[model samples]
Target: MRKKHEAPLDTLNSYLPVGAYHTVMQYLGHYKVHLTITKERRSVLGDYRFAVHGKNHRISVNGNLNAFAFLITLLHELAHLIAFEKYGNRIASHGKEWKLVYGEILQQFLLLDLFPPDIANEIKTTMRSPAAGSCAEDGLIRVLRKYDRKGDVKKLVEEIDVNGLFRTDDGRIFKRGDQLRKRIRCLEIKTGKIYLFSPVYEVTPVSHP
Candidate 1:
């Protein structure tokens, strides 16, 4: 009998890269995971919640991600689940144990050659010591962005030239300023307020006269 939490293989296929359905399904079925593909979230790419009190392990990934990003995010969350099962909340969430588990699981997919050359290389480098968040790996995120839908017009904040004008999705305009460490400073046009933005923040470019 099919577990109530298990998604049908065909339905799950749409959310994953080609050739990934069977392997991913095996994990989900074995663990009885409840996976949800959610709309884009500003704060997280995916999240994991371990089973408790009759509830099954739950994982959620952003629906807006490209196939490669989606797969990586799913694995990220799955690692959290696996680590929790192994260590039973006795270790840090993103500590050595979690990183080791994440790396090993990620390596399995890497062997499949499911990603483009550049993306695969970046993933290999990142797997050595996986970060708490997939987006924290700038090189990996940059490479993954190439696979985003072609119709998407948004550009990363880092892609904007210094002093270039850009508009956030919320309709606010800003002038891209210098980078202060990892974050970029952008001056808001409306209130003249400056804000630090993630390098990967997506905004539309505003052409100047």
Candidate 2:
């Protein structure tokens, strides 16, 4: 069977409103960040990797990702760029710096109220709840349901949590990547580092009709 071709960035670019696109560019400039988005298998829903040779950066979003997921992934990667630019190597991978930026960006995105009422409600609920193991399953469900809904899918886009998925362990909350990608609260004996894993599933963002 022939391999299916993924949609190009330019094709996706046409779907984005000029205002939103420019806003993203402005935010990128504020952090002196440069990134290229491509269709690839990121370890998670989205992946942000820095370039080794240049000031350039790269963000990979799954080729089959829906519009909402794509937008959220872009924002999530932006949070990483902002955190790295501001804190350098001082902050933990999914530490306070990331949380601050994530919250701020989330707030900005929500202010636009671009999501559907139901999905927006879910986003608000998830934001308020502590990141616990129980929430991931339900959160994933809510995100997926909103994505699959037809008509005015852009309304559901705001519901995607781009910054990163959160998970709870023993009442303590940690963002995805704090541990391994599957086992929660997995410990590394040598480094004494904590790992937050990503939820093992794929969700498509809802498309606007």
Q: Which TM-score value belongs to model 1?
A: 0.89
Candidate 1 ranges beyond 4 A from true positions: 1-8, 207-209
What are the per-residue Cα lDDT tens digits for candidate 1 across 16-62?
88888888988888888988877746667888887989999999888
* Residue 28 lDDT (model 2): 56
Estimate, for each residue in 170-209, the C-alpha lDDT of model 2 and write its tens digit: 2332222333334434333334466543344332332221
Off by over 4 Å in 2: 1-12, 15-19, 29-34, 38-42, 51-54, 128-137, 149-209
List the global CA lDDT of all models. 0.85, 0.51
Best lDDT goes to which candidate? 1
* Clash pairs for candidate 1: none
lDDT, candidate 2, equals 0.51
**How good is model 2 by TM-score?**
0.56
Reference-based TM-score of each model: 0.89, 0.56
Worst 10 residues of 2 by lDDT: 167-176
